[model samples]
Target: MSINKTNRSSLRYQSIKNDGYIMERLEELAKQNPVEGFWKCYGRIRNSGTIVNHKKLHRLYKKMGLPLRRKIKKRLPARVKEPLAVPAYFTQTWSIDFYE
Candidate 1:
């Protein structure tokens, strides 16, 4: 049995300290947005001047149980009923409001 040069590549290093921070933040954001992505959080953190490697964040994100985003269809707009002309008779006119 032998290993080829191509099979052996540069080792990926992960930081336990950074993983803790990343995991904490990932869980916090996940609570707010159930389908949040590491790349999105990476961009936000970078934009806030807290720049870090995307690869590291990606790894930490997975370790914290975050996954890829899923497609969700937006809800349709509600239909509104038009107001009808009021009848002169008191018994003939009835109004209902869901707010009540």
Candidate 2:
């Protein structure tokens, strides 16, 4: 009860300092793309030759309130209208003009 192997196994050395460079880079990217979430940012960092842990980026992303993507509305297609052939003379045009 006083001591256990499980507790001993869980213990591990932790880094005393975090690289401010990664944090600063992440913040800058987030500013540029406010909706970019952890995974995307992590991918960018990796692509840029930075190997920061994803979990750390996730925590920081949440802390900074950045999301993966924004909800953008899809653009609607325009309606196509056919050109009307107007008759120059009133007698030339005839219809069951119920609407008019």
**Model 2, range 1-100, lDDT digits (tens) per residue?**
1365456535767667676787788888888887666777789999999877788878777676666666699999998988999889999987785773
Task: Tell how far residue 77 is off in model 2, in angstroms.
Answer: 20
Name the regions of candidate 2 deviating beyond 4 angstroms: 1-14, 68-100
RMSD in Å for all candidates: 10.4, 9.6
Q: Write the per-residue lDDT of candidate 1 for residues 47-69, one digit (tens) a residue.
A: 87766788887877777767875
Give the residue spans of candidate 1 off by over 4 A: 1-17, 69-100
Q: Any residue pairs clashing in model 2, and if so which?
A: none
Candidate 1 matches the true fold with a TM-score of 0.46
| Cα lDDT, model 1, residue 74 | 98
